[model samples]
Target: MAKYLMLKHYRGAPAAVNNVMMDQWTQDEISAHIQYMNDFADRLKEAGEFVDAQALAPEGTWVQYGGEGRPPVTDGPFAETKDLIAGWMVIDVDSYDRALELAGELSAAPGAGGRPIHEWLELRPFMGEAHTITE
Candidate 1:
């Protein structure tokens, strides 16, 4: 099976149908959203196609390596409008179509009113050790 990376972007995509931010949601809504995500992962695990998944904290810092013995350069976590990756899931699937199907399901996760979010997801295939076509 080929591995694919499913990327959920918080920024850089058109706004979701249910665009209200999490901070605006009720506590129960937030809990439900979290539960839905957990269940999704569990379902994938049962199917044996799940490789790995992770959610990133809203806050992040950019750091660049400095020359030897010097301190690294740090940048802001960035504003809400800046590019922010919400999370990712790596799946080992039988075909490209299967990968896309799973991504569509993920994009349908519940939103504020418990309705489908219809969010956008970026899908990419992993290139394991391989030589260029020219080779």
Candidate 2:
């Protein structure tokens, strides 16, 4: 089975059918949305396709290694980071088709008004060995 990374972006993607932001959603709507995500993951786990999943905090820091033993450089809370990744799910599936199907289903998770978000999920396949450069 091939492993895929399913990325849920907060921005930088096509607008969802239900474009209402999560911050504008009601308490019940948020609860329902969370429940849908949990249920989806549970189903995948039962099917043995779920590797791992987690929701990310909006706040993030960009870090880079400094030369030698110097402290790591840090710069964050940047405007460019507004296109933040909301969360991710790792799945092991039989084929690319299956991975696409799963991502489509995940994109249907409940949003505002308890309707399907119809969001766009970025599905990326895990790469194998690196190839040597040829002249």
Global lDDT scores for all candidate models? 0.89, 0.92
- What is the per-residue lDDT of model 2 for residues 88-120, given as tens digits with 9 covering 90 to 100? 999999999999999999999988999999998
Write down the worst ten-residue block by lDDT for model 1: 76-85
Which candidate wins on lDDT?
A: 2
Candidate 2, TM-score vs. the true structure?
0.87
Q: Which stretches of candidate 1 lie over 4 Å from their true place?
A: 131-135
Superposed on all Cα atoms, model 2 deviates from the true structure by an RMSD in Å of 3.7
* TM, every model: 0.85, 0.87
Model 1 — TM-score against the truth?
Answer: 0.85
